[model samples]
Target: MSATDPPPKRRASIGARRNPASQAAILAAARAVLAEQGYSGFSIDAVSRRAGAGKPTIYRWWKSRAELLIEVYAAEKGALRAATTGNLAEDLTAYTAALWDFWRDTPSGRTFRALVAEAQHDETALEALRGKFLPERLQDVRALFGAAVARGEIAAAEVEMRLALYVGFNWYYVLTDRLVDGRAAIPAAMRLVAASLRD
Candidate 1:
């Protein structure tokens, strides 16, 4: 191919290059790589190779493996919409259990563990993890709690504290304690959040 030549054909994956669907294709590929390879083994070359994308494409979108993996986290975790209902306890339990199920049943959870460990050294991943991804997830849960408040099911003061309290307390379990054997844990915490909505 010469400078005048056109770009290669686009991949149908989550983060391909040149096409609008490329981003999605690449992220899917990245998740696969992260799952198979773990933190130290994940790489742009691997993801692009698997994604059928160019190295430049990965670099263009993500600054590092952590960034790419985190995006997968954001998307799968519903960065925009966490859950469907606003029943407070029902929504919280649903989303939380969904999250636990995601980690326990899929390779994504392993990648998440790696990402968490890697975040300690990489300030960029840490910032992305804390600022954007975490906030967005919390916001979704908060909205649910807010709904409960509107319904007089819970107090407004306890809304923001829901996800943190749950995630913070359960972090060790999901990260190291093992939430499931080969299936979902049902995440006992999700129930507590709902039950705690009252006196």
Candidate 2:
């Protein structure tokens, strides 16, 4: 208790000494399993095996496959990043391109497709996909357009329809494999959306 003696040095709290290398390994393994086996075949046991970590370790970090999948999707999608270049058209074009690429080019897109198929029969999976994943992307889009409203390029009242137009067009192209030229379609789509909202 002497003043000269350092007051009991505080020890790191329990579970505070997480191994970043281990965590990265688990995430990387999870992504690999997701890509190889897909959402339908994905399992904690498989991820643990692929990760060289035990079930306890995976459970400590994520309680459910859905939880882990959220992280996987976020890591892959870069969290659906949005842009605000002040020019609404350009911003929308960029956002659209990013979204398109994420859905078209990434393994996460295949995982998402599998999730969609699973959701048709699994209520819990459907809830997670609908409640968490879709809304996150939608909110990002909303923010992008909200900026347009603030700048007076788009009417505040038209934000909803504007969002629908952009989403619908993108979905149509992705689903139907029509108009593979996103470069041409993106700018044309932006102009159409702008014309609709022009005051």
The C-alpha RMSD of each candidate to the native structure, in angstroms, is 6.1, 10.0
Computed on alpha carbons, the lDDT of every model, listed in order, comes to 0.68, 0.73
Report the C-alpha lDDT of model 2 over 83-196, residue by residue, as the tens digit.
Answer: 788887887888888777777677776566556666689887777777887777688778878887888787889888887888778766765554356557898788788664
Q: Tens digits of per-residue lDDT for model 1 on 1-199?
A: 2357665465544453346677767787777777777667888887886666877777777776667777777676663356647566567666766667776666666577766776799898898777766776567667777777887776778766765676775577667746665224444656676665444
TM-score of 1: 0.73
In candidate 2, residue 63 scores what lDDT?
57
TM-score of 2: 0.72
**Candidate 2 off by > 4 Å:** 1-23, 56-63, 177-183, 196-199
How do all models score by TM-score? 0.73, 0.72
How does residue 155 of candidate 2 score in lDDT?
A: 84
